[model samples]
Target: MRKILVLSVSAGAGHVRAAQALVAAATGLHDVEVVHCDVLDFVPAAFRKLYAELYLDLVGRHPHLWAYLYDKADRAPREAWFSRMRRAVERLNTRALHEEVARQGADAIVCTHFLPAELLARRIAHGEAVPPVWVQVTDYDVHRLWVQPGMRGYLVAGDETAFRLRELLPDTPRIAVTGIPVLPPFAQRHDRAACAAELGIDPQRTTVLVMTGGAGIGSGAAMVERLLAIDGDFQIVALAGRNEALLAAYHRLAAAQPQRLWPLGFTTTVERVMACADIAVTKPGGLSISECLAVGLPMVLIAPIPGQEERNASHLLEQGAALLALDATALEYRIRRLLADPALRAGLRQRCLAIRRPAAARQALDQVLDADAAR
Candidate 1:
């Protein structure tokens, strides 16, 4: 069997989730032994903790600062002096990661996060005869950090991202536009009535699903409160993803509007929740938007963090798949407008379906395997 190493880092949940989607796609393939792991596992404990926490801290509490830093990093040349220094420090901290990659003895390596790809690129550049490395960018935008030399190929979420990659890497390694892969549940449509019945929500009333992403860009309670003012027969299903205080806040809101407020925290059944909702209000992370597209769920994107998410919002708005909700008032206005027009909602859903790539993980794997065969 051809062993394939699938590596990811838990900087945020999206990269790890994307890697899991790839693993799910490769599960039953008899010819391939797929090994999925975190590259950070090979690094020292302190280095791993600090590296992961720094990202969450910046994006969660200090968003504008995070945005500024993100823009600064992306604007610099891919292999600029400071970038080289940063990568050098990373390499020194993750010395064992290089050895782990070599020890895996895999035919090909796939990275959902950029760090492993950069580390492996160094080995390939040094003529170490490392396994070919394919990178799956988990976002709509390509930052300078992800543009590493000596990559065999890349899979991206959109055409513009591929174009950006071409501009950065003049060599133009084979770039595939395989949309961000989502979980299996998102690929199939659930019965709306059945899902609604299970959740004890009204099937006939318009339902809006709200997700405060892991980054916590927006306040769930505030969005729900703003939605309450809209003149419509609607129930809001607000999900506070892994945030305890927010979940508690939702419970308090639910007390007064028992039939109207559906509060959920850290659910695994997002597809089912989506099935019951007529419209989705969310932060447009790459994976989240991909999942919405897979299910033909129309979206109103809110509180997109400045750099990558703003890029994601622009793409979705231009595609006619989502609306941008800039503030509480805009969110209420958009939701009211979308709820009032069936034709408009249908149009958005159709656009989402048109752009959907539910089997992106499978498509990406096939392409990678084909490349390996040619070699």
Candidate 2:
């Protein structure tokens, strides 16, 4: 059996989601022993928890501030202070990561986030590594941190990103644009109308699905309240993710407006929800963006985190697959505008269909394994 170690962190749900999808895809093809490794956990537990808390605080409570920091990080010279930040983090936990990798006897390593990628890079550089390493760029944009000479291959989410990577490392033959890895359910799920019927939504009416990232970390309450105030004909289904407090808040809000809002707690059926909905309103996390593309669901992006999410949102906007709302007020206006204009919505949906990369997971795994075989 081939032992595959998929490393991810919980800073944001997108990384873990993408890693899980890769595990699902790779296991389907071979006698694969898939393991989820949280590289951040190699550090002290308190430090790991602090990073998680800091991410949520920055994204949910101080988005504009986070955006400003993100801009600075983005604008920083490649391989400068930003790279130093990563190197510092790697230094703190590199020994633990090296021990874990050696202990697992990983035949191959797939990194769904930059932390693990950077960890493996440092370890390999220091002669503390084993196995062939593949870095999956979960975002549409490439961060220099994900680039490492020791990596056997880089699985990019799209062709545009592949172009960008080529500009950075022109001589590398290990780059492949295999699309963004998404759960197998997205590739296998079918029948939007039937899916809608199952959800008790009117199949004929335009249905909008709103989700915060995987953890349901967006302003669902305000958006739902405004949408209900405007219209009730089109159904609104909001997934609140794992935030029990937010779920309870939505349930309380839905109690008075039962006919319009279908507020769901954490669920594994987002693929079905995306299939049934006419469009999705969400933060532009990489996994969510790829899932939308797979099902041809256009997006109204709101409040993406700085750093990687900003890049993901920009990519979608540039491709005409999504509309970005800078704030809650702008979000309301954009959603209303799209809902009112059938032609505009149709155009966005068409663009989404054109850019959809449904075979990403299978293609990425195939290329990674092929490279290992060649070696």
Among the numbered candidates, top lDDT falls to 1
Clashes of 2: 0
lDDT of each: 0.87, 0.80
RMSD of 2: 2.8
Q: Model 1: per-residue lDDT, tens digit, 281-332?
A: 8888888999999999999998887888899999999999999987777788
Clashing pairs in 2: none
Per-residue CA lDDT of model 2 for 1-375, tens digit only, reads 777788988887888888888878875555667777877767787778777888788877787787777767655665687668757865775578768888999789888887777666766778864688888888999876566667878899888888888877645758899988888888876887888777877778788888863222335686677777876468788888887877887788789987677888777888887877887888888888999988888898877777778899999989999998877677778878888898998999899989988888778888877776787
Clash number for each model: 0, 0
Could you report the Cα RMSD, in angstroms, for every candidate shown?
Answer: 1.8, 2.8
349 in model 1: Cα distance from truth in Å? Answer: 0.6
Alpha carbon lDDT of residue 309, candidate 1?
86
